[model samples]
Target: MSETRVHRADVKTAHQDLHSERGALRGEHPGRSRNPLIKVVDLAWLEFEKPDLDRAEVFARDFGFQIAARTDRELWLRGTFAGSPCMVIRRGRTSRFIGPAFHAPERADLDRLARATGTCVRDTDVPGGGAAVDLLDPSGFPVRVVDCDRALSALPEQRPLLLNSGTDHRRTNATQRPPREPSRIQRLGHVVLETRLFARALDWYLDTLGMIVSDFLFLDGRRDRGPTMAFIRCDRGSVPADHHTLAMHLGPGTGYVHSAYQVTDLDSIAAGGEYLAERGYRRSWGIGRHIQGSQLFDYWRDPDRLMLEHFADGDLFSCDVEPGWAPMSTSGLAQWGPPATRDFLGAGPSPQRIRDVIEALRGDNEMDLTRLLGLLKAANS
Candidate 1:
């Protein structure tokens, strides 16, 4: 019998340059783990500390989140999905992101994670009673794995509008009139973070939570050094999951970049954007489709200047799908949109960012002069 073979040129498309199998053949990282503590089901919620609960509540409503629970000191925001609250904001002296909490499938999974990490599970006092095991990632970000007994019921759905396309008329004679209101967020989609210790953090998430990479992006001339960014998805076996539940990139700063929420469609994004604009909220960037996740997205800043995103129609991949690889560049961010903005890129000059660069260079982390220069080049390319 003849041997079977497949050529890269035969399978490669103009859009995709590499896949996990080929990357492994080239001696690149496999982007996953052989063994892990436990596989998390989904993101539970993100915690934040804001100075004013009143102001936060106002923005939360205007941003299309329903108030799940609120107190004088804390405010819990939820989406239309039947799950946990999307976010928990507490009163604090300064406004900053606390961390993210992921949902463990079973109580035993939490026990397994706790035992593996040498940490103990503690009871949570949030709206839904739960137990959580907290641990810090390699980059000093707090990560919590939780198992909650109670789940929030689904709210009324924001139905997508029917449209007429080429040779297809879904909407008969009805006029398209999406109301100018806040985009009703369905669920928390994903979060993007920047880390000075990219390699360590990336490995920690994979090994600890059993996450698998959906895509890997490397600097043009630094492929030998491995990927500088990864879009990671939860390991749901044969079940399809979001393309990325969490994304991390190499950068001088080690903190949140932006978090995204799923909306209905492009009409929701446009109408919701108008609502935010009329309310005098600042838009960072977006109203475009991204190449990686294929999400129609719009980015805005809350009153505290934290970046949040409204997105819809994101890609979903099963565990069988191997990670794709591409070169990182500003132009590669979107398939069709305005050029990446300085605010979205975090390229605008700021004293704190300058200090972060200096501190990262001085500290013993993955970031260095050459890597920083490579990132800057990739950002401006």
Candidate 2:
């Protein structure tokens, strides 16, 4: 007999509700083609256009990234990972998420992608010298896949300390006080976005990147309308991958929702939150375990108000794992945490958000008034 793990009493109900409502629907496309032009191995970095490079650099440093390289017009930031630069911030008049760079499984994949997409393979101008092919996603997000043979030297990392628990004690007479410093990020875990056409965008990613859906969340009583959000992961064959390397949600605005970076463990997330809070950085939501990926998470706003998350203890899945389906609800997002904040819900009042609402109402898209009202009601409840 196998032992079953139990959750805390406070979060047990929500966790059980999620499991109970996880319908028989697996989000995979049964007829999805087995071969993709190119397979992406991992996420390389994200590109951002911001008005102020100086402010962005400060925030990046405080967020635990070391300056990899910098120029008057651009900045490169790296994590503890061997990747030369995990993030790029370019000077622009307006702040927005440009896109992400994925790692091509092989150098030959670059030529394959370029030829298939009718794009020319070119030398990457990013910090890492490599070959790359850039393509636009269905949602018009920039997607770059790089094939590189070189990487910057890895940075030093603080290994997780031995922990003591009720039944097992790995530490004897030693106190635990995680340093009140920026949590050292291991690498970019995932990025999420909201798109007006969810199904189209979802298919585009699955067909193009050879990614698989890990889970799907549909509106209650409207499963026929399809999933409103999907957690997708790279198809790494027998090797396990993060539950979701990327996710997309149906919303009025087609913009970046947030990007998550991996930290060492729960202590790093909590202590890092304290460091960020002390520096007057805004925390969106956190110190909670998510229902989907089971990651311990903390969210914060960058200087540009872009949401970024520090997560640890995330679930990993093999290719054989089938997608799980559940209803989209605020209670289902987290197993336990402070109630989902408006900022995290994308319901916070903003000029751009207001414009998006107007555009969605006037346009025939997924974010119609009926669905919008349903989301609002869910958030309120």
lDDT (10s digit) by residue, model 2, range 1-381: 223223233233443345435434454343123676766878888999999999998999889888888999999888897875788999999999999899888888888888899998889867758888899997889999998768988889968979878989899888887789999988899999998888888887778888887788877777776778888888897788998999998888898999999989888888888999999999999889999999999999997889999999998866666666777888888989888888888777899888998998888677887788766766675
Task: Return the TM-score for candidate 2, rounded to 2 decimals.
Answer: 0.91
- The candidate maximizing lDDT is 1
Candidate 2 segments whose C-alpha is farther than 4 A from its true place: 1-20, 23-33
lDDT of each: 0.89, 0.83
Lowest summed-lDDT stretch of 10 residues in model 1?
Answer: 1-10
How much does each candidate deviate from the true structure in C-alpha RMSD?
2.9, 4.7
For all candidates, what are the clash counts?
0, 0
For TM-score, the strongest prediction is: 1
Q: For each candidate, what TM-score against the reference? A: 0.95, 0.91
Poorest stretch of ten by lDDT in candidate 2? 1-10
CA lDDT for candidate 2: 0.83
